[model samples]
Target: MSPANPVAGDERRRLVEDVIQRRILSTELRPGQRVNESRLAEELVVSRTPVREALLRLEGQGWVLFDHGRGFVVTPLSTDEIRETYPIVAQLEQLALTSTGPALRGLAPVLSEINGEFGASTDPARSHDLDARFHRTLASRCGNGRLIALLDRHWQALHRYERFYMTHPDDHRRSVRQHDAIVAAIASGDVASAADQLVDNIIGPMHVLLERLR
Candidate 1:
Protein backbone atom coordinates (compact mmCIF):
# COMPACT_ATOMS: atom_id res chain seq x y z
CA MET A 1 0.00 0.00 0.00
CA SER A 2 2.81 2.38 0.93
CA PRO A 3 5.63 3.54 -1.34
CA ALA A 4 8.82 1.46 -1.58
CA ASN A 5 12.21 2.99 -0.74
CA PRO A 6 13.93 3.73 -4.05
CA VAL A 7 17.42 2.61 -3.03
CA ALA A 8 16.25 -0.52 -1.28
CA GLY A 9 14.05 -1.35 -4.26
CA ASP A 10 16.95 -1.10 -6.69
CA GLU A 11 19.09 -3.31 -4.48
CA ARG A 12 16.36 -5.92 -4.19
CA ARG A 13 15.79 -5.93 -7.96
CA ARG A 14 19.47 -6.46 -8.68
CA LEU A 15 19.71 -9.19 -6.05
CA VAL A 16 16.70 -10.98 -7.46
CA GLU A 17 18.10 -10.64 -10.99
CA ASP A 18 21.47 -12.09 -10.03
CA VAL A 19 19.94 -15.01 -8.12
CA ILE A 20 17.69 -15.93 -11.03
CA GLN A 21 20.52 -15.57 -13.52
CA ARG A 22 22.76 -17.84 -11.48
CA ARG A 23 20.04 -20.48 -11.23
CA ILE A 24 19.51 -20.36 -14.96
CA LEU A 25 23.23 -20.47 -15.74
CA SER A 26 23.77 -23.42 -13.39
CA THR A 27 20.74 -25.12 -14.95
CA GLU A 28 19.11 -25.29 -11.58
CA LEU A 29 16.13 -23.37 -12.94
CA ARG A 30 16.39 -25.33 -16.22
CA PRO A 31 15.29 -24.63 -19.75
CA GLY A 32 11.58 -24.06 -20.39
CA GLN A 33 10.77 -24.15 -16.67
CA ARG A 34 8.26 -21.63 -15.44
CA VAL A 35 9.65 -19.00 -13.12
CA ASN A 36 7.09 -18.49 -10.38
CA GLU A 37 7.14 -14.87 -9.29
CA SER A 38 5.25 -15.38 -6.07
CA ARG A 39 7.34 -18.37 -5.04
CA LEU A 40 10.61 -16.64 -5.83
CA ALA A 41 9.54 -13.54 -3.89
CA GLU A 42 8.74 -15.71 -0.88
CA GLU A 43 12.02 -17.62 -1.17
CA LEU A 44 14.06 -14.44 -1.54
CA VAL A 45 12.12 -12.54 1.11
CA VAL A 46 11.39 -9.79 -1.39
CA SER A 47 8.15 -8.48 -2.84
CA ARG A 48 6.59 -9.74 -6.04
CA THR A 49 7.39 -6.38 -7.61
CA PRO A 50 11.12 -6.91 -7.51
CA VAL A 51 10.81 -10.50 -8.66
CA ARG A 52 8.68 -9.49 -11.60
CA GLU A 53 10.95 -6.59 -12.42
CA ALA A 54 13.96 -8.87 -12.31
CA LEU A 55 12.29 -11.41 -14.58
CA LEU A 56 11.49 -8.70 -17.07
CA ARG A 57 15.10 -7.57 -17.03
CA LEU A 58 16.19 -11.16 -17.50
CA GLU A 59 13.88 -11.46 -20.49
CA GLY A 60 15.78 -8.60 -22.11
CA GLN A 61 19.00 -10.46 -21.35
CA GLY A 62 17.71 -13.60 -23.15
CA TRP A 63 17.66 -15.67 -20.00
CA VAL A 64 13.89 -16.00 -19.78
CA LEU A 65 10.77 -15.32 -21.81
CA PHE A 66 7.26 -14.19 -21.03
CA ASP A 67 4.77 -16.73 -22.26
CA HIS A 68 1.17 -15.59 -22.70
CA GLY A 69 -0.34 -18.14 -20.35
CA ARG A 70 2.64 -19.71 -18.63
CA GLY A 71 4.21 -16.47 -17.38
CA PHE A 72 7.97 -16.26 -17.34
CA VAL A 73 9.87 -19.38 -18.33
CA VAL A 74 13.51 -20.16 -18.82
CA THR A 75 14.40 -19.59 -22.47
CA PRO A 76 14.65 -22.97 -24.13
CA LEU A 77 17.97 -23.76 -25.73
CA SER A 78 18.02 -24.44 -29.45
CA THR A 79 20.51 -24.84 -32.22
CA ASP A 80 19.19 -21.69 -33.79
CA GLU A 81 19.81 -19.77 -30.60
CA ILE A 82 23.32 -21.25 -30.47
CA ARG A 83 24.13 -20.35 -34.04
CA GLU A 84 22.86 -16.82 -33.55
CA THR A 85 24.32 -16.07 -30.13
CA TYR A 86 27.69 -17.80 -30.16
CA PRO A 87 29.21 -15.84 -33.02
CA ILE A 88 28.09 -12.54 -31.57
CA VAL A 89 29.63 -13.43 -28.23
CA ALA A 90 32.79 -14.64 -29.93
CA GLN A 91 33.12 -11.38 -31.85
CA LEU A 92 32.50 -9.28 -28.76
CA GLU A 93 35.14 -11.22 -26.83
CA GLN A 94 37.56 -10.82 -29.71
CA LEU A 95 36.91 -7.11 -29.74
CA ALA A 96 37.36 -6.91 -26.01
CA LEU A 97 40.70 -8.70 -26.16
CA THR A 98 41.95 -6.68 -29.10
CA SER A 99 40.86 -3.46 -27.45
CA THR A 100 42.67 -4.47 -24.29
CA GLY A 101 45.93 -3.63 -26.11
CA PRO A 102 49.10 -3.61 -24.03
CA ALA A 103 47.17 -4.26 -20.81
CA LEU A 104 46.51 -7.79 -22.01
CA ARG A 105 50.23 -8.34 -21.86
CA GLY A 106 50.11 -8.06 -18.11
CA LEU A 107 47.33 -10.65 -17.88
CA ALA A 108 49.04 -13.33 -19.95
CA PRO A 109 50.47 -15.08 -16.92
CA VAL A 110 47.16 -14.93 -15.09
CA LEU A 111 45.27 -16.33 -18.06
CA SER A 112 47.76 -19.18 -18.44
CA GLU A 113 47.47 -20.04 -14.76
CA ILE A 114 43.69 -20.13 -15.00
CA ASN A 115 43.86 -22.32 -18.11
CA GLY A 116 46.13 -24.67 -16.23
CA GLU A 117 43.62 -25.03 -13.42
CA PHE A 118 40.74 -25.25 -15.86
CA GLY A 119 42.43 -28.17 -17.60
CA ALA A 120 43.39 -29.90 -14.39
CA SER A 121 39.99 -29.66 -12.70
CA THR A 122 37.62 -32.62 -12.78
CA ASP A 123 34.67 -30.70 -11.34
CA PRO A 124 32.48 -29.22 -14.01
CA ALA A 125 31.50 -26.18 -12.00
CA ARG A 126 35.05 -25.32 -11.07
CA SER A 127 36.26 -25.89 -14.59
CA HIS A 128 33.49 -23.72 -15.97
CA ASP A 129 34.26 -20.98 -13.50
CA LEU A 130 37.94 -21.07 -14.37
CA ASP A 131 37.22 -20.99 -18.06
CA ALA A 132 34.96 -17.97 -17.58
CA ARG A 133 37.63 -16.36 -15.46
CA PHE A 134 40.22 -16.92 -18.15
CA HIS A 135 38.19 -15.22 -20.84
CA ARG A 136 37.10 -12.40 -18.54
CA THR A 137 40.61 -11.80 -17.32
CA LEU A 138 41.92 -11.75 -20.84
CA ALA A 139 39.54 -8.91 -21.64
CA SER A 140 39.52 -7.11 -18.31
CA ARG A 141 41.86 -4.34 -19.33
CA CYS A 142 39.87 -3.30 -22.36
CA GLY A 143 38.79 -0.13 -20.47
CA ASN A 144 35.37 -0.17 -22.01
CA GLY A 145 32.80 -0.63 -19.29
CA ARG A 146 29.78 -0.95 -21.58
CA LEU A 147 31.54 -3.43 -23.86
CA ILE A 148 32.66 -5.49 -20.90
CA ALA A 149 29.18 -5.50 -19.39
CA LEU A 150 27.60 -6.56 -22.65
CA LEU A 151 30.14 -9.34 -23.05
CA ASP A 152 29.52 -10.50 -19.50
CA ARG A 153 25.78 -10.76 -20.09
CA HIS A 154 26.30 -12.77 -23.26
CA TRP A 155 28.89 -14.97 -21.57
CA GLN A 156 26.51 -15.73 -18.75
CA ALA A 157 23.80 -16.66 -21.18
CA LEU A 158 26.15 -19.08 -22.93
CA HIS A 159 27.37 -20.53 -19.64
CA ARG A 160 24.38 -22.83 -19.30
CA TYR A 161 24.96 -24.23 -22.76
CA GLU A 162 28.67 -24.74 -22.15
CA ARG A 163 28.05 -26.39 -18.80
CA PHE A 164 25.52 -28.74 -20.35
CA TYR A 165 27.90 -29.85 -23.10
CA MET A 166 31.02 -30.18 -20.94
CA THR A 167 30.38 -33.89 -20.41
CA HIS A 168 32.34 -34.75 -23.54
CA PRO A 169 35.91 -35.60 -22.55
CA ASP A 170 37.39 -34.46 -25.84
CA ASP A 171 35.80 -31.05 -25.51
CA HIS A 172 37.62 -30.58 -22.26
CA ARG A 173 41.01 -31.43 -23.70
CA ARG A 174 40.41 -29.38 -26.79
CA SER A 175 39.41 -26.30 -24.78
CA VAL A 176 42.56 -26.53 -22.71
CA ARG A 177 44.71 -26.67 -25.80
CA GLN A 178 42.87 -23.80 -27.40
CA HIS A 179 43.15 -21.71 -24.28
CA ASP A 180 46.82 -22.56 -24.06
CA ALA A 181 47.33 -21.34 -27.60
CA ILE A 182 45.49 -18.09 -26.90
CA VAL A 183 47.64 -17.46 -23.86
CA ALA A 184 50.77 -18.25 -25.80
CA ALA A 185 49.80 -15.80 -28.50
CA ILE A 186 49.07 -13.11 -25.93
CA ALA A 187 52.31 -13.78 -24.07
CA SER A 188 54.23 -13.40 -27.28
CA GLY A 189 52.68 -9.94 -27.79
CA ASP A 190 50.73 -11.14 -30.77
CA VAL A 191 47.40 -9.54 -29.97
CA ALA A 192 45.92 -10.38 -33.36
CA SER A 193 46.87 -14.02 -32.99
CA ALA A 194 45.48 -14.12 -29.46
CA ALA A 195 42.19 -12.69 -30.64
CA ASP A 196 41.98 -15.25 -33.41
CA GLN A 197 42.69 -18.05 -30.97
CA LEU A 198 40.10 -16.64 -28.58
CA VAL A 199 37.47 -16.74 -31.31
CA ASP A 200 38.41 -20.33 -32.06
CA ASN A 201 38.16 -21.15 -28.37
CA ILE A 202 34.57 -19.96 -28.44
CA ILE A 203 33.42 -21.16 -31.87
CA GLY A 204 35.10 -24.55 -31.49
CA PRO A 205 32.89 -25.65 -28.60
CA MET A 206 29.94 -24.08 -30.32
CA HIS A 207 30.18 -26.71 -33.06
CA VAL A 208 30.64 -29.46 -30.49
CA LEU A 209 27.55 -28.36 -28.57
CA LEU A 210 25.57 -28.17 -31.79
CA GLU A 211 26.52 -31.76 -32.55
CA ARG A 212 25.50 -32.88 -29.08
CA LEU A 213 22.18 -31.13 -29.53
CA ARG A 214 21.49 -33.14 -32.68
Candidate 2:
Protein backbone atom coordinates (compact mmCIF):
# COMPACT_ATOMS: atom_id res chain seq x y z
CA MET A 1 0.00 0.00 0.00
CA SER A 2 1.37 3.39 -0.99
CA PRO A 3 1.64 5.39 2.18
CA ALA A 4 -1.04 4.49 4.76
CA ASN A 5 -4.21 6.45 4.13
CA PRO A 6 -4.51 9.07 6.89
CA VAL A 7 -7.93 10.19 5.64
CA ALA A 8 -9.32 6.67 5.85
CA GLY A 9 -8.03 6.35 9.37
CA ASP A 10 -9.68 9.63 10.40
CA GLU A 11 -12.99 8.57 8.89
CA ARG A 12 -12.84 5.21 10.63
CA ARG A 13 -12.03 6.97 13.89
CA ARG A 14 -15.05 9.23 13.50
CA LEU A 15 -17.27 6.25 12.69
CA VAL A 16 -16.16 4.56 15.90
CA GLU A 17 -16.80 7.72 17.88
CA ASP A 18 -20.27 8.21 16.43
CA VAL A 19 -21.37 4.66 17.16
CA ILE A 20 -19.88 4.61 20.64
CA GLN A 21 -21.31 8.01 21.43
CA ARG A 22 -24.76 6.85 20.38
CA ARG A 23 -24.49 3.83 22.64
CA ILE A 24 -23.46 6.09 25.50
CA LEU A 25 -26.33 8.49 24.93
CA SER A 26 -28.88 5.72 24.51
CA THR A 27 -27.60 3.99 27.64
CA GLU A 28 -26.62 0.84 25.84
CA LEU A 29 -23.23 1.64 27.27
CA ARG A 30 -24.37 2.65 30.72
CA PRO A 31 -22.37 4.93 32.93
CA GLY A 32 -19.33 3.38 34.62
CA GLN A 33 -19.30 0.46 32.22
CA ARG A 34 -15.96 -0.63 30.85
CA VAL A 35 -15.15 -0.18 27.17
CA ASN A 36 -13.37 -3.18 25.69
CA GLU A 37 -11.08 -2.16 22.90
CA SER A 38 -10.75 -5.65 21.44
CA ARG A 39 -14.48 -6.33 21.52
CA LEU A 40 -15.24 -2.95 19.97
CA ALA A 41 -12.60 -3.31 17.30
CA GLU A 42 -13.94 -6.70 16.28
CA GLU A 43 -17.51 -5.49 16.37
CA LEU A 44 -16.69 -2.44 14.29
CA VAL A 45 -14.47 -4.44 11.89
CA VAL A 46 -11.68 -1.92 12.17
CA SER A 47 -8.26 -2.04 13.73
CA ARG A 48 -7.72 -1.12 17.36
CA THR A 49 -5.98 2.13 16.54
CA PRO A 50 -9.07 4.00 15.43
CA VAL A 51 -11.11 2.77 18.35
CA ARG A 52 -8.34 3.83 20.72
CA GLU A 53 -8.14 7.25 19.12
CA ALA A 54 -11.89 7.68 19.33
CA LEU A 55 -11.88 6.80 23.02
CA LEU A 56 -9.17 9.35 23.71
CA ARG A 57 -11.20 12.06 21.95
CA LEU A 58 -14.32 11.09 23.85
CA GLU A 59 -12.37 11.34 27.10
CA GLY A 60 -11.63 14.95 26.24
CA GLN A 61 -15.37 15.47 25.81
CA GLY A 62 -16.00 14.10 29.32
CA TRP A 63 -17.93 11.14 28.01
CA VAL A 64 -15.46 8.69 29.51
CA LEU A 65 -12.48 8.48 31.86
CA PHE A 66 -9.27 6.52 31.56
CA ASP A 67 -8.67 3.89 34.24
CA HIS A 68 -4.84 4.18 34.14
CA GLY A 69 -4.06 1.47 31.52
CA ARG A 70 -7.17 -0.51 32.36
CA GLY A 71 -8.95 1.16 29.43
CA PHE A 72 -11.85 3.68 29.62
CA VAL A 73 -15.05 3.62 31.56
CA VAL A 74 -18.16 5.58 30.75
CA THR A 75 -18.52 8.55 33.06
CA PRO A 76 -21.39 8.42 35.47
CA LEU A 77 -24.27 10.80 35.01
CA SER A 78 -24.48 13.28 37.87
CA THR A 79 -27.49 15.10 39.23
CA ASP A 80 -25.08 17.80 40.30
CA GLU A 81 -23.79 18.13 36.77
CA ILE A 82 -27.33 18.45 35.50
CA ARG A 83 -28.24 20.99 38.16
CA GLU A 84 -25.24 23.11 37.32
CA THR A 85 -25.19 22.70 33.53
CA TYR A 86 -28.89 23.07 32.71
CA PRO A 87 -29.11 26.58 34.08
CA ILE A 88 -25.97 27.67 32.29
CA VAL A 89 -27.29 26.22 29.04
CA ALA A 90 -30.64 27.85 29.71
CA GLN A 91 -29.21 31.30 30.42
CA LEU A 92 -26.87 31.17 27.46
CA GLU A 93 -29.68 30.05 25.16
CA GLN A 94 -31.74 32.93 26.49
CA LEU A 95 -29.03 35.34 25.52
CA ALA A 96 -28.73 33.70 22.12
CA LEU A 97 -32.45 33.92 21.40
CA THR A 98 -32.73 37.48 22.70
CA SER A 99 -29.83 38.69 20.61
CA THR A 100 -30.73 36.51 17.60
CA GLY A 101 -32.91 39.45 16.47
CA PRO A 102 -36.05 39.57 14.34
CA ALA A 103 -35.08 37.18 11.58
CA LEU A 104 -36.47 34.26 13.57
CA ARG A 105 -39.83 35.98 13.85
CA GLY A 106 -40.64 35.04 10.29
CA LEU A 107 -39.67 31.40 10.82
CA ALA A 108 -42.74 30.42 12.82
CA PRO A 109 -44.18 28.12 10.19
CA VAL A 110 -40.92 26.23 9.97
CA LEU A 111 -40.69 25.94 13.73
CA SER A 112 -44.31 24.88 14.01
CA GLU A 113 -43.79 22.22 11.40
CA ILE A 114 -40.85 20.84 13.30
CA ASN A 115 -42.84 20.82 16.53
CA GLY A 116 -45.62 18.92 14.80
CA GLU A 117 -43.14 16.30 13.66
CA PHE A 118 -41.73 16.13 17.14
CA GLY A 119 -45.15 15.57 18.63
CA ALA A 120 -46.08 12.95 16.07
CA SER A 121 -42.78 11.12 16.32
CA THR A 122 -43.28 7.55 17.52
CA ASP A 123 -39.70 6.35 17.82
CA PRO A 124 -37.66 7.40 20.84
CA ALA A 125 -34.50 8.11 18.89
CA ARG A 126 -36.41 9.92 16.18
CA SER A 127 -38.22 12.02 18.75
CA HIS A 128 -34.94 12.97 20.38
CA ASP A 129 -33.59 14.00 16.98
CA LEU A 130 -36.61 16.09 16.09
CA ASP A 131 -36.51 17.73 19.49
CA ALA A 132 -32.89 18.70 18.88
CA ARG A 133 -33.63 19.96 15.39
CA PHE A 134 -36.39 22.16 16.74
CA HIS A 135 -34.04 23.88 19.16
CA ARG A 136 -31.12 23.93 16.73
CA THR A 137 -33.21 25.62 14.08
CA LEU A 138 -34.15 28.44 16.38
CA ALA A 139 -30.70 28.83 17.87
CA SER A 140 -29.00 28.66 14.49
CA ARG A 141 -30.14 32.19 13.88
CA CYS A 142 -28.79 33.47 17.19
CA GLY A 143 -25.95 35.42 15.42
CA ASN A 144 -23.54 34.54 18.20
CA GLY A 145 -20.95 31.89 17.51
CA ARG A 146 -19.57 31.49 21.03
CA LEU A 147 -22.98 31.08 22.63
CA ILE A 148 -23.99 28.52 20.05
CA ALA A 149 -20.85 26.48 20.66
CA LEU A 150 -21.49 26.41 24.39
CA LEU A 151 -25.11 25.42 23.91
CA ASP A 152 -24.09 22.55 21.65
CA ARG A 153 -21.55 21.32 24.21
CA HIS A 154 -24.03 21.37 27.08
CA TRP A 155 -26.68 19.75 24.92
CA GLN A 156 -24.67 16.52 24.77
CA ALA A 157 -25.57 15.73 28.36
CA LEU A 158 -28.95 17.34 28.19
CA HIS A 159 -30.03 15.19 25.26
CA ARG A 160 -29.28 11.94 27.10
CA TYR A 161 -31.00 13.10 30.27
CA GLU A 162 -34.03 14.32 28.39
CA ARG A 163 -34.28 11.02 26.55
CA PHE A 164 -34.12 9.15 29.83
CA TYR A 165 -36.77 11.42 31.35
CA MET A 166 -39.11 11.68 28.40
CA THR A 167 -40.00 8.00 28.44
CA HIS A 168 -43.62 8.42 29.52
CA PRO A 169 -46.37 9.63 27.24
CA ASP A 170 -47.14 12.39 29.69
CA ASP A 171 -43.56 13.59 29.57
CA HIS A 172 -43.53 13.57 25.78
CA ARG A 173 -46.76 15.53 25.55
CA ARG A 174 -45.54 18.02 28.10
CA SER A 175 -42.31 18.54 26.20
CA VAL A 176 -44.18 19.00 22.94
CA ARG A 177 -46.40 21.61 24.54
CA GLN A 178 -43.41 23.43 25.98
CA HIS A 179 -41.77 23.38 22.55
CA ASP A 180 -44.91 24.80 21.01
CA ALA A 181 -44.97 27.58 23.53
CA ILE A 182 -41.37 28.47 22.75
CA VAL A 183 -42.12 28.53 19.03
CA ALA A 184 -45.15 30.72 19.62
CA ALA A 185 -43.12 33.09 21.73
CA ILE A 186 -40.54 33.40 19.00
CA ALA A 187 -43.21 33.92 16.39
CA SER A 188 -44.79 36.76 18.37
CA GLY A 189 -41.44 38.55 18.42
CA ASP A 190 -41.26 38.37 22.22
CA VAL A 191 -37.68 37.35 22.75
CA ALA A 192 -38.07 37.67 26.51
CA SER A 193 -40.96 35.24 26.62
CA ALA A 194 -39.24 32.82 24.28
CA ALA A 195 -36.08 32.97 26.34
CA ASP A 196 -38.11 32.48 29.49
CA GLN A 197 -39.72 29.40 28.01
CA LEU A 198 -36.30 28.07 27.09
CA VAL A 199 -35.11 28.21 30.67
CA ASP A 200 -38.28 26.76 32.19
CA ASN A 201 -38.51 24.08 29.53
CA ILE A 202 -35.05 22.81 30.40
CA ILE A 203 -35.35 23.14 34.16
CA GLY A 204 -38.78 21.57 34.41
CA PRO A 205 -37.68 18.08 33.39
CA MET A 206 -34.36 18.60 35.12
CA HIS A 207 -36.17 19.20 38.41
CA VAL A 208 -37.61 15.69 38.24
CA LEU A 209 -34.18 14.09 37.89
CA LEU A 210 -32.88 16.24 40.70
CA GLU A 211 -35.70 15.02 42.93
CA ARG A 212 -35.03 11.39 42.05
CA LEU A 213 -31.34 11.78 42.82
CA ARG A 214 -32.23 13.25 46.21
For residues 60-124, write the lDDT of model 2, one tens digit per residue: 88888899866799988889888888888778877877887878797678989999998998777
* Distance from true location, Cα of 175 in model 1, Å: 1.3
TM-score of model 2 vs. true structure:
0.94
- Please, what are the lDDT tens digits per residue for candidate 1 over residues 174-213? 8999999998998899998988888998998889888878
Backbone clashes in candidate 1 total: 0
State model 1's lDDT: 0.87
Number of the predicted model whose TM-score against the real structure is largest = 2
- Taking all chains together, each candidate's TM-score versus the true structure is 0.86, 0.94
Record all residue pairs in model 1 with backbone atoms less than 3 Å apart, i.e. clashing: none
RMSD to true structure for each model, in Å: 2.4, 1.5
**How well does candidate 1 score on lDDT at residue 53?**
90
